[model samples]
Target: MRLTYSARKRLGATSAGVVLTVIALVMLAPMAWMAFVSTKPDADIFSRTPLSAPEELTGGHYANLFDQFHFGTSITNSLVIAGATVVISLLLGGPAAYGFARYPWRGSGVALAFLIVARMVTPAALVVPMYTIMQNLGLLNSVTGVIVGVSVLNLPFVIWILKPFFEQVPKEVEEAAELDGLTPGWVFFRIVLPLALPGIMTAVLYSFLAGWTDLIFPMTFITDANVMPLTSSLLQMQTGYRIYWGELMAGGIVLTLPPVVLCFALQKYLLRGLRTGY
Candidate 1:
C-alpha cells in the first residue's frame, strides 16, 4: 500500500523529529544526571535505581560549597575575569576585524593568516611560556593575569568571526557616510556596528564562554584561593583519597546555569548570526 505524497512527507517529518529528540536527550543526559545528583543526599546518590526520584531534596551540597569551598568568592572572581576578557576581546578584535575586512594594506593577508595560526596553537603548548612570562612580569596568581591570558586566547576567534560579519556590510553605505563628512571611526561606530550587531553579540557570547569555562590558564596561573575561578575551584573538590561528588555536582550546576541562561536569552540573535554568517 503506497502512501500519498502528503502522508509520506508527514511520516518523514515525524521520523526526523524523533531522531532529533533522541539525540538531544543523549547530549543532555549527563547534565540532567548532574542536576539530579546535586539534589540527592550522599547516601542516596549511589542507589541501584539512580534515576528514581529522591524522597527528599536537600541543599546540603550547595551549602557546603559556599561554606567550605569559598565558592562565593570564586564566582565573583570568574565573573570579573570573564567580563574583563569580553571587554578586551571586543575592544581589540572589533577594530582589527574591521581593518581586515575593509582595508587592503600590504601584508594584510599574511597578518590575518598569522592570527588564524595563533588561534590554532594549543593552550597547553603555550602554558609554560605564559607562566614564565607572567611570573617575570609579576602577574601570576592574580585575576589580572587570568583576564589577560583568556582575552588573548579569545581575541583571534573574535576577529575571525567578526571579520565575516563586517564584510557583509555594503561598501556604498560607508561611502555615503564618508560623503556626509563622517570619519572612518565615526562611520564604523554609527553605521557598520549597528548593521553588524548580531555578529558582535555572537562574538561577545563566545568570548564570554571561552573566558568563563577556561580551566587550564586559571589552574596554572592562579594558585591563590582568593582569586580562583569556578573552573579551577572545581578541582578543590578532589582529594588524594576521594572526590566530593555531591558538592562537585552542585558546583557544576551553578557553573552551567549562567551560560545556559545567557544562550537562551540571546538565542534569536545567535541563531540569526550563525545562519546569515553575520
Candidate 2:
C-alpha cells in the first residue's frame, strides 16, 4: 500500500520512539526496583506476594540507616576518599597524559604499555602487597590511605584515557603558544586544558566511579567502622538474622544517586569524549 509522506514519517518516528522507550525502561528497571524495594517492609522483601505499595510508608529505613549502620559517617568517608581520588588522579594523570601526548620518547610506547598492564592488574592481585605496604606505612584504617591506594590504581587509566584527547589537540596551537613565548605550563593550563575539558571531565567521572564502586580495597584495608566507605558499609546492611530490607535498599538507593547525577549532568560532553576524546 502507498503511504502518505507525513504518515510514513510519523510511523517511522513512532517506531523509533517505542524502541527507545523500551530500552530506557530496561536500563532503568534495576534502579526503579531498588527504589520500590526501599520503601517496602522487611516481610515484603523476600515474600512471594506482589507489592502494590509499601506495607507501611515511613522514613524508618533512612532513619535506621543514619542510626544503626552509621551511614552518615560512612557516606562522609566515601565522599572524602572518592573526592580525593578524583583530584589526585587528575592532578597526577594530567601531566602524564600531556607528556605522553607531546613528548613521545625512546621508551614512551613501552612505558604506556606497562601502564596499561598495570591498569589491567586486578585489585585482588595488589591487595596482599598493598595491605603489606599500608601496614608498613601505618596507612591502614585511614581515609587518606584508601584515597591514595585507590588513586594509585585509578591514575594509570586516567592517563591512558586522557592521553588520546591531549593528542587530538592540534599541534599548531602549541606551536603558536610557544612562538608567542608562553611557557609550557601556561600553554597546558590555558590552551590545551580548555580544549581538552570534555576528556578531563570523563576521566574525572570514571576515576570517581572507580573509587566509589570499589569494595575490595576498603574491605581489606579498613579495620574500623568509622573509616569504612559506603561500599563496605553497604555489606553490613545484609545481616544474617534480621535483614531490614527497607534500610538496606534505602542505603543502596542513596549511595547510587551521586554517580547517576554526575553522569546525567555531563552526559552531553561524555559522548563527545567518547567519540573524539575531546
Candidate 3:
C-alpha cells in the first residue's frame, strides 16, 4: 500500500529521532560514567559495577584537584591561552578571509591553497620545527609560546571557515555604505563584520577550543606547572607508582565543562554559521 505523505513524514521523523537518541546516548555514556566516577569514593570506583549507583559520593576529589594538583592555576592558564588564541585568530583570519573573498590579487588562489595545505600538515609533523622556532624566539617554557603555536595551527582553519561567510555578504550593501561616506575600514567593520558574525562566532569557538584542549604544544614548549594549561596539567595526576584515578576523573570533568558551556552559549551562532556558508 502506498503511504500517505503525512504518514511517510511521520515515519521519517520517528526514524531520525530514534537515530539521534541513540547517537546522543553513545556520546554521553562515557561522559556520564566519568561524572559518576568523579563523585564516587575511590573504594567504590573499582569495587562495584562501572555504572552502578554508589553508596557514597564525595567532592574530595575536586578539592584534591586544587590542593594537590594546582588545578586553579591550570584553569587560568588555559583561559589565557584560549582567549588570546581566539583574539589573534579573529584579528588575522577575519581580514584575510575578507580579502580572499573580495580581492582577487595575483597568486591569491595559490596563496590560499598553500595555506590550506599548511593546515593539512599534522601537528606531530610540525612539532620539531615549531619547538625550534619558539626556542629561537625565546618563547619556550611560556604560555605565550603555546598560544603562538596554537594560533599558527588554528589560523588557516579560521580563514577557511570565514571566507565563504564573507563572500556571502552583499557587495551592494558595502557599496551603499561607501556612498554614504563610510570609509572602507568602517564599511568592513560596520557592515561586513556584523553580517558575518555567525561565522566569527564559529571561528571564535573553534580557535578557543584548539588552544584549550591542545596538549602537544604545551607539553613540548612548557615545563612550568604555573604555565601549563588544564589539558596537560591533567597529566600530573599520574605518577610512576600510582595514578590518582579519582582526581583524574575530577580533572576530566573540570576540563570538559568550559567547552560544554561555551558550546551551549554559542549553539545558535554555530548552527547558523554551519548552515549559512554552505
For each candidate, the alpha-carbon lDDT, in order, equals 0.91, 0.86, 0.89
On residues 1-278, what C-alpha lDDT tens digit does candidate 2 reach at each position?
Answer: 99999999999999999999999999999898888888776667777864576457667778889899999899889888888999999999998999999988999999988987888788888888989999999999998777877898898888878998899899999999999999988899999999998788889888888888888889999979889989998888777786667887898888899989887998885675566432
Lowest summed lDDT across 10 adjacent residues in model 2 is found at 269-278
After superposition, the stretches of candidate 1 with alpha carbons farther than 4 Å from their true spots are 272-278
Compose the digit string of candidate 3's lDDT tens values, residues 142-255. 999888878998999889889998998989998899999998788889999999987888899888889899999998898888888998888878989999999999999999
Best by TM-score: 1
Q: Between which residue pairs do clashes occur in model 2?
A: none
lDDT of 2 at 155: 87
Q: Give every collision pair in model 3.
A: none
Best by lDDT: 1
Q: Could you give candidate 1's per-residue lDDT for residues 26-142 as a string of tens digits? A: 999989988999989988997898878889999999999999999999999999988998999999999999999998699999999898888878989888898999999999989
Quote the lDDT for 166 in model 3.
Answer: 91
